[model samples]
Target: MPATVFSCRWFALCALLLLGGCQPDQPAPPLDQQLYIWQRQWRPAHEQALSASRADFSTLRVLALQAQPKAGWSRARVDLAQLKADGRPVIAVIRLDGQLPALDLDRARAQISQLLADWRAGGVMPTGVEIDHDSGSARLSGYTDFLIKLRGLLPPSLKLSITALPAWLDSPQLPALLQAVDSSVLQVHAVSNPRLGLFNPGQPRDWAERWGRVSDKAFYLALPAYGIAVLPDDGGAPVVESEVALNRGGERRELLADPQQLATLARQLRAKPPAHLAGLIWFRLPLPGDRRAWSLSTLSAVARGEALASQWQVQLSARDGLYDIRLDNLGNLDRPLPARVELNAEQCDGVDGLSGYTLRQTPKQLIFTRQSSARIAAGGQRALGWARCTRIDQGAWNVYP
Candidate 1:
């Protein structure tokens, strides 16, 4: 070979090697879809929920039990019998209260051992056990110690994981904590105050990237798929209400995680998935009647990366000299309630909008203006208002012009 040609081929090989080294060692593969069934108690709705969601969600991370501060352990009402029948693997999770000042290690292990034995007797073997503790950054050392000890009881066949918080990224011990578990779930949501909102589109990607750089273990992002209502307590701090209800009477503020924003984030993650990133696990599965959560149709659409859209339809019913107004969502995506609705009416003695809408009476028409950003779920209907009118065509209403 000629000396110049040999030199050129050597330089070309070096350039190719350097370029390959600069990029990710491997291309980001398709993300696996999973869900966190965080409901403290199981209900009949779960049967249908599991069946409907089984097609999209490949695995479930269930809240098997909780370790409360003074309340000790509150075992979840999850039907173990149905887990195997559902035909998806499950990861049993034990949530320890972040408020708890101390870790009761022995009791937790005893409870877990019994829980596992019970599950086995019930003919269900979970894929792994995940520890979900919202410990502060300062406690990462102690938390890692606990996880290391907990690792002993888990068999080699089962993989151990933890529900990690974004705040832990600042802790140096985070790597050790990751080493103690087979994997971790990075939760990107925090409903601190309604004013701040449930999710910020840009921040979670930052967390995923930071975590990927810090840990070698495989991890998944826990995204929000639900909303919460907040009310002020006697103190100034906000009290968040999720699946459970509060008995106190006070004005409430609601914060919802936008479906569109979540869908956009999902696509972005798929485009450039973080290192060791396995998939996404949506927080708390949604039931058909879950007023605070997105509908299954919306979730499925978001999971599959279908286009986000919604079509509103005005449904009017008249009987007994009264007309009722309802809006139906014809599209698969959940949509923000229309801000304005106008309908021509011949004789509307009185009209009023319901819930998030307010009625405005014009000389010849009735108008409804939305008061909030509440969204109507896909394939669902909401009664906007009613009017006692002499005559109005059912198809005369216009949602927005």
Candidate 2:
């Protein structure tokens, strides 16, 4: 054999080895997704929201009933006709007030039974029943007993599930509680102090690891795709204002989950999924006119581990000295409306803005300002204002972050 031929073969082998080592990592497997339609009453918009989100979520968890401190009990007027029409696997969520003094097993059982009857009569049979009681750690033993009794009355074909809290991990009875149900949904959203905001990005990963070790059965994680408005503290518990109206006398601070951060977390969970971790469940599906929830495009992207972002652009149209200025979001995420928008115009007869914006005009400029933060939906545009001028150059505009 020639020395040159031997050297060439050796180099080729080395190149092949290098290529193998440099191959891209395997893509993470897709995770199953579910959504919680938590509105108390089913309106026209709920049907629209559900119809549009058919591709993103497989199962629907509807708010069926809720028990409050003094409100006795109120049932969710869920749209049965629509649910029957959609014909998707549904889970009815029954909420028990976390602050209740004791677990009234009899009352809760009655409520569950009646709810099942009502739903069945409407031709909307639920695949499972989930008790969303945020009971305390000390009450875990009692809660377990209640669940066992509740499970006894449920149909054999239907599954029993529970909405579990991270704090339950410290309780020794958590295993027993898990045993009473087929599967559990670990709610990692809005469990911490309201003053600390709704969710802590780093904390959920640690909690998930610990929960995975303790639970033997299949479980899913409940994540936040919505925001909460925290009313000013009045020396008592913070008021959480969701879709409900709160007439409390104080200012409200809006806190929302970051879509990009959540998207990254989803990717991490998929890349190295926890043991027995079934999938992800997004809390409270967003509707068409929902102000606190993320847009469907953004939520779907996060669920699929896609990059989250919104592209903001200034749209200016002029016809015979009448110019219409607007802000449009071209990307797939909702964008916070600009605090201030400034445009340099050569000459302006008059200028103004709309939707909580005031016009600030200078000799050669036009400005629109708003006091509170708002958002522009993906593929949606908002009218910033219009100007009657010779030329309102589209290129001479600045939008402040």
Clashing pairs in 2: none
Per-residue lDDT tens digits of candidate 1, residues 19-67? 9889865656789999989877788888999999988889999999898
lDDT of each: 0.87, 0.87
| C-alpha lDDT of residue 17 in model 1 | 94
Error of 2 at 181 (Å): 0.5
lDDT of 2 by residue, 49-99 (tens): 888788889999999999998898889999899988888799999999898
Which segments of candidate 1 are over 4 A away from where they belong?
A: 1-27, 191-195, 233-236, 317-325, 347-364, 368-374, 384-391
Question: Alpha carbon lDDT of residue 117, candidate 1?
Answer: 91
Q: Supply the global lDDT for candidate 2.
A: 0.87
Cα error of candidate 1 at position 387, Å: 6.1
